[model samples]
Target: MRPISTDLDQALALLQAGELVGIPTETVYGLAADASRPDAVAKIFAMKGRPADHPVIVHIAGRQQLADWAQDIPDAAWKLADAFWPGSLTLILRRKPHVPDAVTGGQDTVGLRAPAHPLTHALLERFGGGLAAPSANQFGHVSPTTAGHVYNEFGDALGLILDGGPCTVGVESTIVGLTDAHPTLLRPGGIPAEAIEAVLGVKLIHHEKPTTAKLRVSGLLDSHYAPRTPLLVGPLAALEAEAYQRFEAGQRVALLHHSQMLQAVCGAECHAMPLNAESYARALYATLREHDGDRFDVLLLEQPPQTAAWLAVNDRVKRAASGWLA
Candidate 1:
């Protein structure tokens, strides 16, 4: 295993040789492998303990390489790519016959994205193929927002980690299923669904679960993006009450609030989260990872407003919370 570095040649060499590299993206760090190699893709699943049935997104340099991995290229996909490529947006299309089943979970459809990170973009161009990458963390855990976070997940096991600093978006891409007549919103993430809808000139079908086809996209599981410590979400009043009770019981507790202030309790840590939606989304995962482990017995979060702007954050919070405090 090697230390984290910004060397492009080393990252490319490892990927080309069918090894894993922790690569950065605007959204989150990805444990990247050559998407064309089933053997290499299998290593990602084994390393993350991710299920074989779960698919990983193939990160390409740009839309020009879309034809190499997918077939039945649709006009909607092109429009979305034109509008959001080199950013946080993933398009799901029919997979080319050559695309490894290991990358698509034996499904006919493959997920594709062109990451906004300059380092990863250059690496993809040099590699000249799609890199199958999921969030650089263990399966069902909180996604990594920095090279250090990636290192925490895999440590010295990964050959190289391209440190591109902290991720700006700090969440996964907004996934759109373009295989059908209408584009379906499989996951709301860095890119808002409303913004994607404005591009397509039609409303997005918000399908929490793809029932008809049973399509599985990344970050769609019910208990995804969770932390090891017990986390609960609710109003500030409820959370503050819970924190006080826990503190009085001589238990370690942490409260994450979006409001201006929370009634502080002795022996409990209170963290003020970003009030703005974008800032909150960017800081959410890293904050969770920071306070997790033996530092606290439980984490209490004040649920953000249920608005379109905070949709992605709310979704992640809801999934991450083990239960709700009334």
Candidate 2:
């Protein structure tokens, strides 16, 4: 499929016409549509094959418009918003009711974000109404950190892709719901759990990934944010042993290391990064996706750092290993 450059007008036209368009964000690329247009929102689910239960995030240009989508935002939320908005962070708040149920997956809450990418802000500012978008990839698949990822996943099926280059954070926003009195983490992303706690003056509870009931957003799915290749999560020694065994069986392998892992392992395509959480989280998915291809049989990922900063990154890695079957 050939690529076509998109501008604000073209993006607005596609969205107003109820067609899906790719919008850029600092965290990742979003398959965007007018949130109020249930037909357009439904198309997002159909195109991505995302479960209706996993809600879409409404992207706004700035903080002032947040009131149009959410309600009863805690003061702590306001603080975090000021600190992180126009960047990577999503706030889950009480929906205004009239907000389309499709955007919330029939839930009372909505996930809203003000993306930092200039291209998305231009589109949202010009065509203002909540834009319900998720990462532009099949549901439960590896997210599109670059436009090529989207092109590879959806191909000619999609019409326009607004490529603002690779997402800097290389993951989704950290989603925190403040509708309740205390702020709780709905999902973790570019924002660290500690940063939120620092502002709230209290620890925010991180909920276990919801499985019994339908999920409300992309990252909340227990088995989502996965790469095409199978992932195995365990200690470096364990991963090395497993990779050796898999290699013995004639399977190609990719080894994910946390610095402590052996520098060189045979029959393994090795990737390494710092044990520090911030650096590790930023590098996680792109590293995995880089090695995820037809050439590799299994992605053997070493255990993540045992620290609070790595919490969200660890969660995603473990979930990626869980696979879509569970």
Candidate 3:
């Protein structure tokens, strides 16, 4: 097993030596490497088994260094950065000449963000360069929101794990593609679409169709953030019925619900999740990670409200539950 540390200098040393470090952000923990080094960047792909063309986001210290990594950043990009940077929004822009193709996944476009996590931000400032990072887990697996999750995923394979505690947002960054004529939401996450639009004073375009020809960003996979245990999402009544049936069959079942009136059933392990979107987002991954460890035969999640605020959490739960949906 790898050592978990609060030392940023040790992490910087490993990163400078072209090694991988598990670093925490407000959203999720990332497997970070030097973005400027192709060899270092390639290690991230190998470690996560990520496709070469699936782009990772490059984390910078602040918006001041944006021009150093990306080229031709638009006015809209600046506004979004002003509103959402140092938080969980990632801006997709044209890559600079020096950014490695490995970092951009052989595309001319690069994903950039300034994370709000104090340790990661301090690390970026001290490292003095961009760190190409994706969620610290196997490709298409449940993203890690804690350092222990990172250790659980890779064990000793990762050189260092920066123990920054539980992630506040507990999901990946919201990715917005700005290279196109209209700003498009590549992925929904920590920040909501309405919030971004409110800041820009313009409605953002939502990418509805799936295509393989253009610049690809992270967290767009159809069956991502899934746990090893099969999961299903539906109404509380339906889930409770199914859980009882499964339990009667002598199978261990886990049910996650947001309802306060719902009492723990006799046969299955029950966990109540937060009702609000923000609180729910913070607990989503950690709840999944916890239940995943119990070796339950099936996990049932009560579907959340289908509102703009619940978009990000709903996206994650939908993907997580997709594996078991027949």
Which residues of candidate 1, in runs, are more than 4 Å off? 210-213
**Clashes per model (N, Cα, C within 3 A):** 0, 2, 0
Q: Which candidate leads the pack in TM-score?
A: 1
Which lDDT tens digits does candidate 3 get at residues 110-156? 99999999999999999999999999999988999999999999998
Clashing pairs in 3: none
TM-scores, one per candidate: 0.98, 0.92, 0.95
Q: What are the per-model C-alpha RMSD values against the true structure?
A: 1.2, 2.7, 1.8
Backbone clashes (count) for model 2: 2
Error at 134, model 3, angstroms: 0.3
Give per-residue lDDT, candidate 3, residue 46.
Answer: 97
Worst 10 residues of 1 by lDDT: 259-268
Better of 2 and 3 by TM-score: 3
lDDT for model 2, please: 0.80
lDDT per residue as tens, model 1, 210-261: 5644798898888989999999999988988888889899889998998877
